[model samples]
Target: MSAAREHVIADLRERISLLEGGSARKVGCLPFGVPEIDAVLPEGGLAYGALHEFAGGGSGAIDGAAAALFAAGIAARTKGHVVWCLTRPDLFFPALVQAGLHHNRVVFVEADKEEDVLASMEEALSYGGLGAVVGELVRLPMVASRRLQLAAEKTGTMGIVVRRWRRQTEASDFGQPTASTTRWRVSVMPSDELPVPGVGRARWFLELMRSRAGECAEFVVGACDDKGRVDLPSGSADRSNTSGRSVYSR
Candidate 1:
């Protein structure tokens, strides 16, 4: 890329970062605040102006709910309203609030087909007004994802694609390549143990499945708090290897 083009992209990134309630000095990425998790990414945070892919570890409802909450928490942290496009109308409103995303901050688009969902996501991402755009679908073709990535890059908006499968067999598609900047898989883990007789905060097993210029790693974290933030449990360690190898290499 030319120097002028690079400068323009950087400026746009910083502008969008500030517009999304981030500090002026911090541009191009959204840090998760946990040192261990942030250290693995090349940007020390989730990059802006990019497309990210996420999916549950399994097809079961519990795993799927975990994945949805993960995306919801991310959207919750941004400043402006969020546009979420999906074929399903079954997202739990209260759960989103618990994940720190208020209902008023989200504009949901219910499309009739997967193709329409992708188209809506691409359009919303290009609008350049929202903090982020989210889409739920079972399959994301490379071409469609590339279009979304380009739209995000053009406007400095983040795009999140949550892969939701109704059948286990459909999940095989997730292994295919895409234009996403990163890919993640979230699974529900046993809740934290409480000294008393009640349940503690939920825990999650997070897998960084792919990254363009970062190491793949895993983490055990307390689920999203009311502020849409996840924390490394006390005494837990980061799972990145010293060599920073990709998960696929393992």
Candidate 2:
């Protein structure tokens, strides 16, 4: 932690940021509007002009729904139209609307294969005209992710990838290395207790599996509301459980 060593590290970070088409001096972020969640992210929020990956914690209906809603919530908070490229046309538009991304603002591209979906995402991101570009893919290789990351950075657009797998075996690919800025997993948790015989707000277990220049962490919070925001349970306890391991290289 000497001054000379610190300076070298800072210089390297700046150079890397520049190469990624962002400035170290002032980078943009998309805060979740929740203090506890934002604090865990290196930049106090999800970094803009970068690629992020999301996947279900397990091969369950609830797990897939939670992960998709998590990504949709983030996209809902952005400014322009959203380009969502997917190989399957099974997305529930009503669920996305409930999560705050209205149908009018989304342009869905149905592709025949995962490769096509990635190609469409890269093209949309490179267009520099949308608020965010989302892709549904089962496997995101390092090279493919790198191209998507670079395209997003050049336009200062957010790139999101939802890793969807039809079989349990395909889920293993999500643990592989990718060039994304961060990776996340979301699983459904039991709803909070209610006084009456009625359903309460949905809860979720969120895991920050990987991040660039940041530590991995996890949290349990209420699911996204109509405003694309999550709420911490009463008391806002710290749930920073991490194994100190990263699935991807920095």
Which candidate number has the best lDDT?
Answer: 1
Model 1: which residue pairs collide? none
Tell me, what's the RMSD of every candidate? 9.1, 10.8
Sequence-dependent TM-score of model 2: 0.83
Alpha-carbon lDDT of model 2: 0.82
Assess the local accuracy of residue 235 in candidate 1 as a C-alpha lDDT between 0 and 100. 51
Compose the digit string of candidate 2's lDDT tens values, residues 156-247: 88999998878889988998999999999987766665899966777778999998999899888888888788878763323232111111
Tell me the whole-model lDDT of each prediction, alpha carbons only: 0.83, 0.82
Tell me how far the alpha carbon of residue 192 in candidate 1 is from the true structure, in angstroms, after superposition.
0.8
What is the lDDT, from 0 to 100, of the residue 61 in candidate 2? 52
Regions of model 2 farther than 4 Å from truth: 1-27, 235-250
Candidates in order, TM-scores: namely 0.84, 0.83
Error of 2 at 220 (Å): 0.2
Give a tens-digit lDDT track for model 1, residues 118-150. Answer: 999988887776778999989999999999999
